[model samples]
Target: MKNTLKNKDISQTPFRRDVLKIFNSHKNAIPLSVIEQELSSYNRVTLYRTIKSFIEKNIIHEIVISGEESKYALSKENKDTPYQQHIHFKCRSCNILFCSELDKAITISLEKHKIERLDIQAFGICNKCNIS
Candidate 1:
């Protein structure tokens, strides 16, 4: 089966489709390890580089939780394509990166200039992983 999701070389990697599946299924945040486990066959370096490419392409964004490690999740733009502009959240304890809707959570309007690349991140305890 051909992967309609255009992230990488779809012709070669069927497992890559699982990565996109996460975006479709979960509205919450996810980390690289979670992604790796979901995809199954993907290796460490390959997954890492694949994630790096996703970040570069704006298919997914990275997050660095304050006092914790980093995580990655999909962007929230409805185009279903790479828009390269959106906000994210990071859980301090879990280090999970969540793709949040900027317009809803935090109203942001740039003066005159259009927002080409958006990387808004909030680091704290997430609702599910809150330590308190």
Candidate 2:
């Protein structure tokens, strides 16, 4: 965790470390409410700021799904890629949001437009849910 912060040039702070730990422990993206529940002693504003900082540094990314609170997950590092371009899947049975890598690269072309980031979401029963 400390190495991740260092790589992103983020200062090593106790609160930041704790927040990263929460993200690391979970395989799925989490909402702010969950983080608050886990770190109940921390101030809400502080947590928000920490999340913002991580986003700015590309240490994490936000997942926005309709009719639900925004969720956050650690960014997958790709030294050659400047932006994250992957699918976010939500299991309807478990309601767990997680990232999934695309099988092939997606190509998009827009006339006179620049795309900085792309977030695609799919909702269905995930593998674990399908087996049960």
- Please list the C-alpha lDDT of all candidates, in the order they appear: 0.61, 0.85
Q: Which stretches of candidate 2 lie above 4 Å from their native place?
A: 1-3, 78-84, 108-117
RMSD vs true structure, all candidates = 5.2, 2.5
TM-score of every model versus the real structure: 0.57, 0.85
What does candidate 2's lDDT look like per residue over 1-132, in tens digits?
A: 432677677899999988998998898899999998898489878998999999988888898877899999988863547554689999999999999888776777689798666668899999998999
Tens-place lDDT per residue, model 1, 1-132, is 322455443333555566767656666666666676766577788777766766666666667766645666665443464444456666668755566554544446789887555467677888877646
Candidate 2 TM-score over all chains jointly: 0.85
lDDT of candidate 1 vs native?
0.61
**RMSD of candidate 2 to the true fold?**
2.5
